[model samples]
Target: MPALDLKGCLDDSPKFRKRIAVYEDSIQHFEFSLKTLTKLTRLQVDSSTEYSQRQQELATDFTSFAQSQDDPIIAHALEKFGKSMIEVEKCRTMFVSRMGQAAYNPDVKPVIQNSHVTETFISPLEKFVKETLFPIKELKKRFEKASDEVDSVLSRYMGKKPKDPTILETAKELADARKGFYQVYMEYVSKLNDIEAKKKVDYMENVLAYMYTKSAFHHQSYEILKDLEPYMRDLTGLLNDTRQRHDEETSESSEYQDLCAQSAVDIYNPLNAVSSSTVSSPGITVPYHNTTENPNKSGYLFERKGGRVMQSWIRKYFSIEGEYLVCSMRNTKTSKDDDQSASYNLRVCSIKLSDSYDRRFCFELISPQRIIVLQAENEKDMHEWVNSLRMVNQKALNSDKAPPPLPSLHRRGVSDVTPVIKLNGFSGSSGTVSDSDKELLKMVREKPGNDKCADCQAREPEWASTNLGVIVCIDCSGIHRSLGVHVSKVRSVVLDKWETESIEVMLELGNTIGNSIFEEHVPSDMETFRINPNSSPIERDLWITEKYVKRSFVAHKDDKAQETVNQTFWDAITEGNLAEGLRYLARGANVDYRNPNEHLQTPLHRSVQLGNEVSVEFLLQWSSNVNEIDENGWTNLHYAANSNNVRLVLGLLKRHAKADIKDESGKTSLDLAVEHQNVQAVTALRLFAFDKQHNSSPANSLDFGFREAMSSFKQNYSFERSHGTSHSALDLRQTKSHSPKESSSLHETGSKLLRSDSSQ
Candidate 1:
């Protein structure tokens, strides 16, 4: 299937629209039914040991009586009806569930989402449930009811009771019940026979109808697709071209529909083979075996033989039948039937190399009933048999992981962007930070009291939480990390990585930003939350959580001088009032001013996110806390990283913006870059880290051309933005480069960054 041409389906014909609506309704129904089935499966069946044991006992007694040729007529009927009904019930459940999954395969689900082809896919399933399972289920129930009555009488008369519990009245009642059960059983069996006899014919007819209906589903669209694909090999080509064109140029042209409809007239009629059906004899044979063979199953074959017991060390034939590894004393030939043929269920059986024996052909098979020592004729045969058994075991256990679909498919949301978004800029490149980034960092570092721990007010706080954006002492950082990444995303100021976007967040909400919310409602009588260097682990945790999480001493937002200072600072940053912001800094005002708003963003944080170079430079020059965090535990770098402004990223990296600072979710600025697929940002961050480690800068770094191009790209982007010019993504991708090696190297670096991230 050439991936149902999604773009071609732009045609809003009445036929297509009708189909789309029907498809949606069917999908809803399927989803609801799936959820209901899942819930049903979760029900605690056979919950208690006594209940399960009783069921087992009933089944065993019934089987034994049914198989015994000498059993009473009523007993035989009870056993036969009971076993048949149970098997049918199990079959119905499994078949329905498996069929539902096939009918609702998620891979093909999107096709239905855009079409009205619901009846084509779903009608056969509905028919099967109605004609096959429903009728079988009804008959099975009647058979079970009759069997239960027979069982009741048998239990009363001669079951596991210690004494003769059968009185004259009870015996008489049992006889009447037995006769009544026989009558019901016969009627139920007669109906069941009728159903079984006609089931295949009815089922095949329904299936044939479904196939014929679906074979022509979207036939018109397929014809259009066929015309579109003479040169195009895979759907990927057409899809990519269509998507790229759609994105590159905003066109609402009806050319696709017009072309499709116009092309239909010139198409010559191709010879069509007349539809016909043929029936062949499906021979049925009785599945009779000498108690050991699995008649219906033939699985992965290993022809060689291995002995069952060490005493019988002569090699014997073994074959897999479903989940069983059946061993026979003789070759698996029709003429020679082994009397001691044994079958071990691979589901519960474990095979391993024999510890006591040195022979290469010897291995041990441990089952629930016995430990069998098997000896193969040769080492190669032994290895193959062992491998075959283990392979069967794996099929039963489902432990292989090479091509799992869950993890790969689940990564489609926030982290779904291309890993290297180097080409597109915020009108800025992904990386190659700017003067704006540098200024934002400087401003945050200069913010008053922002450098110290929010709780302790300890000088030179070395650690911070990206989400809370509050700097903390090392002791408190440890306590914060212990709270789990959710409660406190702690990172080292100097040592950690930082994304440009998170750095911006830190600038937005630093000390002044955090304190107002945490301390707004503080009572004078309450003890301060600050901790000393000597504070114990418990003391640090209590104070940290209480300060950041609990807000134990928080006060109501008071209308005071502090509020005016905060509001003025935020207003200056928001409005790009560099002069006014300077005055506040001159008057000993808080540099990292937090807004009283719910976001609690600081000046530099908001400015970087806004890509305001002037405000960032002014704040940075004023010596604000660059390493400070905002309420969301993000720094200025984080904000810069998320933006298209490569200049903002450059500014922070030049100022040594911590690239490793985790946000509220424990994701670093680099992680955010990767998540957003800011390829340029990722490259710049990694390059900066590499340069920093090697004591190199953009001008001096030996990895020359690409880094220079990135720097140049950032400058050009800033210039364009300043001049009120916007470059399209395609134009950005067309930027002049010195060599293919530059991009290849960047790609390699990005691949390494991803691998490093996984290791972290």
Candidate 2:
């Protein structure tokens, strides 16, 4: 559109107004279009960047697959394909980068002296809208105001008599208003003209720049792909040949039909399936099985007596090659790299089924040098492995060429490995330790500071303090046991059967975390205070006592007033904020801080009363005596039982809360639980009583049956909570700051309800 005439603006005619309105509308449309373009451009750049990243990830996957391939030709072809894909990904990544730069700043320029200004650089379209269009809107507003003032002044001047004193004043006001109107009108018209020209030229120029950047990106990508054309064609030809060879092998396999006729569960052969491309047949896929005639067999198996003293079983990759039984040694933190692969001569070894052994799927390879015992995953796997070994051994014996002589076994010290997630119970709990324990043991020992003793830095810590979540040497464990269960509950990682929750506790806080907490403030100058691997029993005892019992090295905050610290502690407990509570505890907030306003209940008591087990555990970690009594003589256990929360009751007992301790009412927690008819809570308390009778550690209370019962109960309880099922006693209530009288009244009402339920 042509610019609105300055002369027309001076006339202030209806025609001029109409023309200006059209220009203003066009400017609004232009602004909207530019915003849309900018938004779409940003989205396109983001999408392209994501696409490039995904392609790069796919290329990496291709490279990994190539490394795992057995066929040399296929592997080579895949490697070439992977490299080409990576190159294409790089091109796409470059394109994304260029596109982003083009959208953000089409014209590259040297950054200014100030880094902050460089970071805030606005794109061309955005800059034009902000710096050019916004000011034009402001000018238009000023022009309208000036025009209104001139019209008002002129009307008054025209209304006055020619000779009147007011006539001269009105005329002078009219002239001043008209002059201001003229200046604003000219500026507004000038801005309108400038923007109109910019809208036509600048926008087209930006579009041109976008097209150029896009064209350059496509050309670069094309050139990159063009370079790989010959290699891609060759790879395709090689893949075609591989497919033809595979077809030939499938057709010539005499055992394929026999394998298919066998039970589907016993054997899987995908070659027996009807092809999807068959015109008249239904596409039926069968289970896949390798049909190669090779007698070689390799897979993961449990190797007995592999580690030191032959006490632990270790998983090893076993493969039969010719007459040698090759075992791949894994690199664990506890294992050395001296023997990466161990080979046993099958020609001199006698294979026998271990049907008489305690463990299922056991077999023994009796070699002239040493007996190599192995366990398979199942009976079928075991038989298959035995058959493969026998076949290889017989073939070796019949060969005209003499086999290699028997070699000595290279024994490495293997730590007892266990699974982190417990699949079965042990010792104080029910059931024998399963083979799943190996991985968990390895995982725990591999944790930082766990490979060595937490106290003496002894290699391969076999014992762990369950409550403290630290692994220690056998010698250190004896000291930990002496410190009392409340200080550190010790358990044998290998010997003791683990509960899921206990293992989770250990995994959550390994030796690294334990040392970080206990030895947080250990002085560098006091080297004598720290015990080494060579430290004597007396030195270790003194160090352990100072570390766990005395907590001499624990960081403390003495700066905060006792009142402020106690108040913060109460607030954290009330809000169920474990992190904040732990922080304040380190800052000298008493874990046993009594809330005077809430019947002088300690943090632990209050947490149980509020049904906050998480906060209760947090308090226990900070050494909050679970046996501490409230003003009403109610302990945390008493509160937990009265609440009828079975989980909470179990947790308290596990933490060594005195279950037998009587309250002011002359009733123990178990008595209260039974009176309230809290069946789960009562059961938990009774089982705990039995556990205390049989076991020294209160934490190891649940047997297999009881553990299963509790597990089921927990699942059901969780389901109820998740689905918003309401329970009168177990419902978690929101706690608020209340006056002493109100708090007392609330507790009284709760007590009355419990009494009412018991009486009924």
RMSD of each: 34.7, 30.2
In candidate 2, which residue ranges exceed 4 Å CA deviation?
A: 84-122, 162-169, 254-760
Candidate 1: deviation at residue 77, Å?
A: 99
- Name the runs in model 1 displaced over 4 angstroms: 1-560, 696-710, 716-760
- Model 1 root mean square deviation, Cα atoms: 34.7
lDDT string for model 2 (472-564, tens) is 975576677667777777666754455554565465568777777678888776566688875644577789998888777777655678889
lDDT of 1 by residue, 1-760 (tens): 0112233233425564354445435434544563454344334221322233344456556666655434233343445344433332222222222222222222332111211112332444455455544564566576568668877887777653455555666778788877776665555444444444444456456446445433432332233233223112222333465578887555434544444445432121112111111112122111111122223333222222344363324445566766766655544454443335567777778988664764445788888887777765444445556776777776777844342221121224322231121222122222223456657666766777677777766677766666555677644555665566645566545433344655765665676666665655565555554467655344666776776556564542343476686677678767876545533443335878776583767888888888887567657644556667878998899898877466778776666678888889998787877676665567678767776677443333333334455655555545545664323232334554333554445544555665565567
Q: lDDT of model 2 at residue 516?
A: 71
Query: Model 1 misses residue 123 by how many Å?
Result: 99
As a TM-score, model 1 comes out at: 0.25
Q: Give the per-residue Cα lDDT of candidate 2 at 255.
A: 53
Please give each candidate's TM-score. 0.25, 0.33
lDDT of 1 at 320: 70
